[model samples]
Target: MNHNEYMMKKLYEEIIERVGVGIHAVNQEGKTIIYNKKMREMEAMDKEDVLHKDVRDVFRFQENQSSTLLKSLQNGEEIVNVKQTYFNNRGVEITTVNNTFPLTMDGEISAAVEIATDVTRMERLMRQNLRQTKTDFTFNHIIGKSSEIKEVIALAKRATRTNSNVLIIGETGTGKELFAQSIHAESDRSDSPFITQNCAALPDTLIEGILFGTTKGAFTGAIDSPGLFEQAQGGTILLDELNSLNISLQAKLLRVLQERKVRRIGGSKEIPIDVRVIATVNEDPIDAISNNRLRKDLYYRLAVVTLFIPPLRERYEDIPVLIKEFIQKYNELFKLNVKSVSNVVLQFFEAQSWPGNVRELEHVIEASMNLVNYEQVIEFDHLPYQYRKSEVKMAASSPEFTESMEETMGLTDQLALFEKQTIEHYLHKHHSHITNTAIALGISRQSLQYRMKRLDIRVQKI
Candidate 1:
């Protein structure tokens, strides 16, 4: 080799060695002829291992990039900003954002040079930022992903954005609170106060004072405290079981709804408010008006954007997911190692009509987690008895309810009974279509089969 040739080769090697980007030169046959130090580090490979190796043998592209990457390599076209992350043996994932530009010699593609820039930290930060920016109300926390639930969420989100009044109607235990909270969370008011008041929990006078502020001298010992509507200023006020509010109070609420202002007790001046209103009623507002529990005018104002949350029995498909969340919740709270439910027990839960809905199921799982002594998997015996009280012969079931064995029986028996009753109820609800039945039951087809064996429940094949 001449002196100039030697110096030229040394300069080329220096450039490849010092560059931070992973640079690789592959021959026309797709064999690695030159692999830089950075390239070997990115691949977690030794210099000897990658040198003279087939490019296809060691370098793996993403599943969807086969055609574009291979064709570009053959045709000498440049592909840029191809994003990918590769995991190494040490469990470290390296993200590469790069361009693959082919080298042509004498007007024909001969070799290709890939310039890969390490972007692991950047990619991780981007993902973290995306997660942080995610709306506080998530599809996951909302429970059901059914089409009905999806439509409701989308409409609720739109309503929240516009500051419209929302009236949520659902049977008791149908997760009215969840929907109310989600709407508030997804709205611009998420960072503001989310005040909740159950109208039925107070007497008419007390309820009026709670919803609207009272003057210090209005009544004996009145301290001029602001009520829920004032407290929720610049945010949202959730009126739970709004139908329970009496006729007179409804008139006051309707005035506020129309005027967007409130007058303190014994005070002539009206104080303006920017509070958004969200009310939930277990009964239909129309029925409430007919029965004189709710005023027709107030109902129309509150129902500007109405949402109905279906009963637990109606959306039985969500039972299993809710149960699992409750199980994980209790496991964390009680510091238990319980992992899952047995097929029979799961089937029992899936099939039952959860009249009490998510709240009822959560209570049952929490009780069962505290009851089970040895098994990691919750069996039929781990459930409560209200579930199966009708089925158990009274005398024979007494020994199972002994107080000495309360830890052994009370919680578990209740859960089991609840699970059994729920399964039987849903089976009847679905008219016993095993597929729809299994879906409502929230278990695998196989698990349902085993449960049928244990419960001695029969259903004619659809």
Candidate 2:
């Protein structure tokens, strides 16, 4: 090869390796021939494991479709922005969008190349939002040590003793549903079904039909259906955000609660339901009534057995326990060794009134942990962009971070530090098995060996 051509080839290869997207290419026979670093990271596979292997064998799906690369190679079709799911050899589910193009040589298709963008985390999060609660998750999932929370739990535990309806009032994200599930799990109806419906999630027309069964001719394209109440007949139904219901629906719900009977939308028969009721409201009951968001009479009936959950601000003592729990949780989840939060972060967290309560704090920590690669402590820089405002405000008051920590190394030195720590962590995890560590780190074994040598990580001797 000439000097110019060789230089150009090297530059192109470097660009492919450094690109921020996954790239994989397959030969005409559908064997993976080229897999870049990003591709290895995305699929959690080494090039050695993928190269020369048939694409069909590396990934599978129940839809019985060929891999995108194979499809492109066989049909000479250019597939763009197609979102699909694949089960890798390890049975890990992956979701991604891909652009695939068939490469031709001498007017014949010779290979196919795919550019992939991983969306597995996003799609799973969306699914978790939409999926129904199973209720096997019991009181153990509730994390708190404060007497306020303990008293609430005690009251909820008492509520489970009887079949009386329950009203849980709390700020949003204060673990109302956890209490509901805990009650259901401990109730006499534990063997029966437990169902939940968000009353505020639907409109008047749809929610009425959903909560109260609909006849075939009840509305346009309506079919005979049993409502959520009937579905929970032998168990419990949790109506979330009860105050968000329209006044008319509130009256209807009140009637159902009072009468213990439900009449279908268009039917004359009143069906007797033997379901236990548990409902939640995300506001103070008195204000909800004054604002016309809730009916006083209905509130009186639902609050027959009331349990109030204190918000995070009201229970500041639980912050340290929660932080430790979350750190341990995410350490197991993300496969890392995050030991704790820095003192400043902990102080800032305790000082702030978490408007979103425990859920918000958990998310902040989760996002911060995602940024923590090799750090033992989650520093202020690891806080998400949304929380940076709070840091700026805090700096004005105390100037903690600016004075306490200063950059001690250049970019190259810092990069080396991170690499050394990361390699050492993975080495410990994999018992210094070079191939396993390399696969876990998304690098070829030889590359990992070279990096270890340069970083002075001596555990490869094991």
Candidate 3:
């Protein structure tokens, strides 16, 4: 070859080897011809082991029938963005998004070239992102003027003065993390890292390593890595759905809380850490303890300061305010000028049960805004399909049989009656399971029991 052709070929090979993606090519006979540096790194294979080898012999496909390179070569076709996951000869699993096309010469297929992007690190990053939270919430951002919520806010503010571990109990989507973040923002540790992990987001085996650092040779593919505790040094780490952790891990967590130190998964030495932990539970703490999902001793340690966020249903007066705030938020987010909701839509929203709590309310408003035109009020027609159909489920006015009874009762008594009826409906619907009923009512089991007693209601066994 001439010097210019040789230089050009050398440059092309160097560029392909150093590229970010894994590049592999096979001859028409399915022999491994060109495997670049990135490909070797992605598969954890040595160049000497893969070069000039049979492609099928070196890369062990989970299913031979679904191999992209083989299929592209056999059919003389191109495949784009096919997700392939398989183990190499060393049993190391590799996952990649692959694009394979048949190389041609003189209108005849000569080989197949495959370009793959390793998604292992990307998947880990996505999981970490799911567990991470960023909040700009403080006491003033809590968005409620009701007396009940104001009382809760007062208690939360009191918690900011101390550095004790806090346990926040609330139903799903009741903004437990918001309260956690607000406390962190107001506390002495506000300047430090505010890391978060959802305890239920991972399996038990993985969750342990993620919370406590993993040591080298701890297990297969395990490296010496700092866990969330180390990452949140001198700061606060929020463990959402803390009750989802099993009892054994809970014991380890208890030790961490008691000693203020954490030992890596396979290490003998303990590392001292100064981190305030804030844990959240969607179920009633009492029920969680009874169900063995939470260790009583650990609960005592974590609940040194407890905060209970009341649900949207209990603080129904906050609905209108929350709706207005959501409207303003979507106006800025979607860049539309939605003014207000129709009176009929507002009445329906206030009367309907929000099973998903505040998050659900936000979704409803955002969806309605998407359907409404700019500078127009959101009418019932603009509501989501399910919400529009919910109007048919609303009950008609009271019958004449209760008219005389309603006259004698004061407003407080009438409100109490309404509350009792709502609780009863949820209790019966959930077959009287305290946990389920309390969750449906968006209150803790203890609070639900108190309401039941105050209203003179009895739960019959199903």
TM values, all candidates: 0.56, 0.59, 0.64
Candidate 3 on 182-268: residue-level lDDT in tens? 999999888887888888877887788888977766654455678889878888899999999878999999999999999999999
lDDT score for candidate 2 against the true structure: 0.81
lDDT of each: 0.72, 0.81, 0.82
The better candidate by TM-score, 2 or 3, is 3
Q: Which ten residues in a row have the lowest lDDT in candidate 2?
A: 397-406
Pairs of colliding residues, candidate 3: none
| Candidate 2, residue 236: lDDT | 88
What number of backbone clashes does candidate 3 have, counting pairs of residues 3 or more apart or in separate chains?
0
Off by over 4 Å in 2: 1-133, 397-462
Q: Give candidate 1 misplaced runs (Cα > 4 Å).
A: 1-139, 391-462
- Candidates 1 and 3 compared: the better one by TM-score is 3
Looking at model 3, which ten-residue stretch has the lowest summed lDDT? 392-401
How much is the lDDT of residue 381 in candidate 1? 69
Off by over 4 Å in 3: 1-135, 395-462
Top candidate when judged by TM-score against the true structure: 3
List, residue by residue over 303-385, the lDDT tens digit for candidate 1: 88999876665555566677777777887788887888876666556556566767777788887787787678887667777
